[model samples]
Target: MRTLSPFHYIVFSPVLFLDKKQNSYYKKINNSVGNDAGSFAPLSFYNNQPAALPVPWDTMLQKGRDSVLARATNNSMGINNEYYNAHIKGKNGRIKAVDFEHNTELKDFRMLMKLIRAYEVDAYFVMQPLNPHYYTNLKDLNPVIDEVRKEIKGGRGERAYDCADFFVTDTARYDKALLTDVMHFSEYGWHLVNRAVMNHYALK
Candidate 1:
């Protein structure tokens, strides 16, 4: 559930988390830059559903914000600038925040930059394209994501966009129409996702 080194945190990613000690998992992604590969398959939106399993983020964020606020109030209380400063220099330095709303279950390039700048651990992020409807609804997520990116880049820098078939908007097709579950995607949908991942990273 938790690791002692690197940072004390959690990451729910669509990609595989590698095995290693001192953040090898984080650095392994750098391999993607070599050629351009992708994930084995598109992570099914079905993965986002609640099958008595880990709660989905969008759902959990909305459902638990109040509780999180309450808990923060109980613990952190007010801004202890002194305490915050110390943690930022020490504990926070070891943190790596990874988001999973995009195609590969990671944040956009901009968010990647911000997270990298905020801490000292190995940092990376991937942007997964969403279906038209969900992408339109969740597009606003880009702003927050960009904010994180800005934090990492500091001034400005270039970013790479995913070239995979992330959006499954062809309603004419019978396969996609089956994914009407609202949150999770169907099997065919994930196929395209996996394809895109492999293409992007140039994976074998």
Candidate 2:
């Protein structure tokens, strides 16, 4: 089997900076599963396989496994259906506003950039858009965004794309149709993001 190593190009998003807690949780899940789990669990299933799976059976099994794993991890992290549902409904109860000046996440982000540069990798950091409804202090976030841009440029010497800026000068920022929830973009919003990225890179 091929081991997963660092790649040539990496696209990071503000989601990394925003949800720092998720990183620790992912580590916990990895530790809980242990190194032998993947090898041993699949071995048992391999010996009992039928000639062929029924139509959609493999897909269903994969989905079921994923759902169960996700649920287990979320439960371990103290996230329940109510919390998830509130986030989906554009609630900001758990969303932490970025503290651009003194946020510790920036230190980690800068370290990441340094590591990526050491490997001579082309790295792109994307500042994702947030649902306007989710933040009552939208005006306060502008400085935070500016600080983020400055920090990335100072540390990586590479300009990061602030996808949120594309909407700032337009009426689109207020359009709820552009977002699926508190932090995710809808299809049209993603189309705009793709266009913006292509244009920035001068891609044909």
Q: Which candidate is the best by lDDT?
A: 2
- In Å, residue 2's CA in model 1 sits off its true spot by 29
Query: Where is model 2 poorest over a 10-residue stretch in terms of lDDT?
Result: 1-10
Positional deviation of residue 34's Cα in model 2 after best superposition, in angstroms: 39
TM-scores, all models, native as reference: 0.29, 0.43
Q: In candidate 2, what are the lDDT values of residues 86-191, reduced to their tens digit?
A: 5433344223444645655655666776664454443445565554444444455565556556655654455443333432322244654444443445555455
lDDT score for residue 58 of model 2: 42
Q: For each candidate, C-alpha RMSD in Å?
A: 18.4, 15.9
- Show the colliding residue pairs in model 2: none
Q: What C-alpha lDDT, on a 0 to 100 scale, does residue 130 get in candidate 2?
A: 50
